[model samples]
Target: MTQTVSSTDPPTPSSTRPITRPTVVGAWHDRFEEILTPEALDFLARLDNAAAGRRADLLAARRARAHRIRHGEDLDFLPGTGSIRRDPSWQVAPPAPGLTRRRVEMTGPVTRRMTINALNSGADVWMADFEDATAPAWQTVIDGQLNLLDAIRDRIEFTDDSGREYRVVEASQRPTIVVRPRGWRLCEKHLTIDGRPMSASLVDFGLFFFHNARELIARGAGPYCYLPKLESHLEARLWNDVFVQAQALLGIPQGTIRATVLIETLPAAFEMDEILYELRDHSAGLNAGRWDYLFSRIKTFAQRGPEFVLPERAELTMTIPTMRAYTDLLVATCHRRGAHAIGGMAAFVPSKADPQAAERALTKMRADKDREAADGFDGSWAAHPALVPTCRDAFEAVLQGRPDQRDRQRDRQGDGVAVTATDLIGTPTTTPPWITLTGLRTNVSVSLRYLTAWVSGQGAVAIDSLMEDAATVEISRAQVWQWLHHRVRLAEGLVVTRDLVTELMDHEVELLHAQATDDRDHRHVDEARDVFVETALGEELPAFFTPYAYVRYLVDRPLQPAQRPTAEDLRRSEVVRGHEVRSEP
Candidate 1:
């Protein structure tokens, strides 16, 4: 199903057509066609036509703000939104029906098998992620939506290549389904309205809400969402407005859609109170998205000097002054506004092959959960199903008989947990003793491995027993860039240089090639090197590597009219795209 499009002719626009007559741009699959009907495409078109302009404006604003920061403009809280934060009387909407007891939550990509497993993973909530946790292949995106639709109907099941069967439990035993759509920055190139790509966020949300909002509501749940990578309160406001219009379009109640914002970016941290205030009607809570928060910090202040250059991802613990301020402020803000405060992901995937390692991972997870619980977090995220009980036990100890600790508002006025602008920036004035060669190698290895899997339509990869996502790769490559930019000194007093990084990357690439099981793996290893070097050593850092890589590698071509694409075709496109494109390291 490799669609060969004429570069001379792109998808055509249908702006003058009726709402029911929008055109879908990519090749269609029969399975996906079941969920991506004309009605669904029309709904997405309506959403795009309505809010796409605002989305573009906001993105432009982001670029302008980044330019200001690059020119030494300081970042601080918004004076314009002061009254909303100062008004002590306002609160977010009450928790939606099934989201009230989220002591432990599981998140993963929405493959058919993963979907069934996550729903039965014994957690209070299952966040079916189409964002960082998923590779944005055309088939992967639509298949995910179909999986969720089938799961909602209790007809979803999977049989692996080894013939192992997977199925969901009875409705009474399933976790609450909450979808995390693609961020606002991404566009669904496979689908378009008026020849313009629609926001991936709206496409994911539109199809899911259009189909499942009524079904979820009928079953005592609502169309709950987790908004990711929002950098400002205004972004949250855009999502709130989308939620409002989505509910109304489907004839559902205004407050039926609930969303939790991931305060993962540096700017979003400063505006946590305002973000909640904007979406108060449909807000669920704010999550301490630790990895992305760290990545955001580095990206924001990468040029600010060695003060902001992080040593290693593992060294930046949650207990650091900056991280503590973030969590403390998040808990306080959510509780102040009657929203649940969710903690960050415990991404330690347990290994049965090594009992001692599993125990160590569990112990670290226990400590992390205990800290969040003590800090008054209502719930937290687990990347693996095995760690769910451990997380539950940690929170259970603190929760006692209560569903959540939203009642335990650690307010600055009363609890003495004060967080300032300086604390949020969390820059260390002093330099570390040394950066290690092992850290550099680890970054290269992990980034390469993760990028390989990502190019193959897998987003969440378990490497060295840690669940790694796009944020993990972002931090990995960004650190290399930051280290090179600062000429960071190693433990042996040698300054890290671009040549040194290239040498190490070449060695790692050779090592991976030796371990390659086939030509396909070898090519991925090669492309991984290309993507890493391009992103890490470029004159200007690309905002996100996924989108650039996706357009260049994941898509084969435009679909022929009435032609059906297959999963195999999508997989082949990755290899085809890899072979056709080459970049210098």
Candidate 2:
């Protein structure tokens, strides 16, 4: 049902006229009240009012495009936007303060301790992620905003249960804060303007910009962001419009806001030049959001055939042809436009309990960073603060006193690097190696572990010496679906049928139940099992698991009655606006 705000609603009273209050539809906690102040809600409403319709249109367009692809449509760079791509005279706005030296950036959830730790982690930039790294619970959303606010003011601090203290370090020692808001597909149901839910993207960006944009400017930094899950240049255009309007509304300069987009989706990969062109005025650069990109590839090409069926997630390294093409194109495109081409995440988490494992993990991380640096990427992401120095040293080896290699154009004539649409597609000609039992078990374990924490409002968790986030969960579940659909054979020559998958899922659930140490853990494990089964084994693939799991498990709401709607109820329902009414004799 679609709910529209009525035009006849009462206007803001004179006392609250300057900053109109919004109707918050969900429960309000103590700290939530601080973040959702009258002015902040009003600001969010303004953003929603301006961009909500266009967001809806673009989301509909996304569905249409996907539908066309399913009907055998091919994807290539848009000829419509060719002029924007071919224009050689244009460049994005220069890197904003603190963004110039993003040689090693750290990413994590915006929890209090994480905010402090990431800022003090000695990386060049800290991406305070509210998207994939966050679960989007109401309290989490509000608290993340509060944490960022406190971090900005240098008042954030925390102490562990073991009595270890944490506090923001001296301003000079801290990493520059770059906030990543939720994507366009999510809506903040807790807050509604005019009966319709506001975009979560707008809400996160709105609250943060309202509270901190001016302060950041005063601190010699501007409101910087990492845009995620964009699938087209239209989406980038929407964000650029939002930035321009936001700066105008907040009295900041037009170009004060800078954004680095995550070219994560398959479609966005084709529109690299256009994506940068759309946001050129506010563009910082682009990052190779590797995991999600792979997930997107599987999702987009799932039904195409065996050629698109990916190998085990562990086996598909960045050096693979498809990945190399994408990264090469990204670096080439960014350098051509004078933008930084940041690399993918090194998600290895060192273990304190095992020296050998820690050494191996560090070695792997160093190698990954070395490849990214050698490939002409300006910087890369580290999932843990401990990996920062390894990333820094790797980049430092090639950078040699340079902040970035934006001047190193990879696509110049005689550069010996050539990337084309065909290269980007890079469909495998041979079948992938058989799925190993260990690989299958790893998928089940990691997905279950990650989903358990996710349902409990922890979006980022360290599992088996690796940091797992939503992207990891996506990859795991998508692999399960692809394997099942393809009836993939294991090394033992046993096929992955429904029965086998169900048996393994049940075994994993039992293992988790056995390991549960508390009621909370037990409940979360149960929910995780359900989430995994439904998302991985449903008749049709779900576009995303988070939205369904979010409403079912995360939102703090009362259960609805199970009664069917009556004729009178339907007649009077505001949600039935678009339906035709008829009287029966």
Candidate 3:
């Protein structure tokens, strides 16, 4: 059942030396050979050999820092990097082509349909998210690369089960593409190097950069990227080095790869200036990754005290004092250094079933985008195409034909944005008794349904009109753990305990079954429940639920050749690229 794809390697100069090829442990899908070519695999192997050790060291440093924080070490700005912050003369590199006017960027997974829809959404930039918005099934990983390649060449198309067609707009009309690879902590278990799993970050970035860097440059856009889950400036330094080596090895000009780091972690927020300094030569800007920021806040200080107990996820918004402080500091820091300060995702998806509810959601979304535009943010993100115009209009009102507002020096003009370390970490700003029965139920319902869909290969699920991704799910589960750890009692006089959570989860599962129209919905509910109990109800709070759940549930064996089909594999058949095939027969 072992299948290997063969294709000619890209022509290498005679001066180049051979590289050890990384083993492809995943199954081969149709036309996957186009992307997993010999030269491409070699490129990934070389990049891994160069930076994998540094990546591992930084991840270990992250764990050590988290351990220290939980054991009573206070989190604050680094005293060592004060010189980088105080020095006013440094600035990030100017924006590359297709990145300067990112006023209404659309964010979605790189699925074929979603990819075409996002590029044609009329947004200034389309972030093809391979992290939160994508469930990293092996087929999904390879298929996404193929879709990107086809889209860039203007040959991508989609026909649904009913034969309805989907096509991308002309190349001139499409939004600029920016890829968000997997974070440093995750591993591409299917791709091994020296008998160890390759860093998923490098696997994703290396594959895309090797195949598309030249084509994208010829199209007037370079290999732009968005780095996620960065915990420190050192992580940024590692990525910068990777970019440098990537461009040099490929013979593309240095500084052609521009990256926007997501300042989602609490430690990253403190080291913003130093991070920009580290990647300043190839920096696009920083994003106010609000959802993961909240998750980080809870995870970092959950064991310390009851003071860090967070309210419900819905109750924590951009208006909260701490969140406001985070955004203000981000905008100020980015604007101070002449980088585009992009805002966070607007997760509302216009409800097709209810017009009134849709109107309300749009109104809320508009207000959020308007506030961000007023706060000196150059642009923001929308989860759906319908929400793009709202985001665009809000920024347009302030931009008035200007590409960005990076010229506004919000850091120098006001004390309102003068955020301190205490302002960033001081939580429960509102009154106590924040946890409500509705909040607890909402968390349970979201956890069950989202995880169900996630295990079934859908990373971005629409739950109660919001586009729920890994970041939002992380926030939900983290809140549950924080509440349980603090013994939080709702206003209804019900204490959050293992028994109560189990009861609620059972009830939610019943409701999900009743609402299920087919077996697809029921197929993964039990697995999702197992994941929820393990991650949310455990004694120790796990930093993320994805790594554990992914390894346990989503990893599958490679597909057999098309001609060989066993009865077991036939029972587990799936529709891949319009063909009904047994994945592991």
Whichever of 2 and 3 has more lDDT, that candidate is 3
Give the deviation of candidate 2 from the true structure as CA RMSD: 6.2
TM-score of each: 0.91, 0.91, 0.91
In model 3, which regions exceed 4 Å deviation? 1-19, 412-415, 427-433, 515-521, 558-585
* Residue 54 shift from truth in candidate 2, angstroms: 1.1
lDDT per residue (tens digit) for residues 206-296 in model 3: 9999999999999999899999999888778878889988998999889999999999999899889888998999999999999999999
The RMSD (Cα, Å) of candidate 3 is 9.0
| Candidate 1 residue-wise lDDT, 334-354, digit = tens | 999899999999999888899
**Per-model lDDT:** 0.82, 0.82, 0.83
Clashing pairs in 1: none
Q: Give the alpha carbon lDDT tens digit for every residue of 447-525 in model 2.
A: 9989999998999998877888899889888888888887888887888888988888888889888989999999999
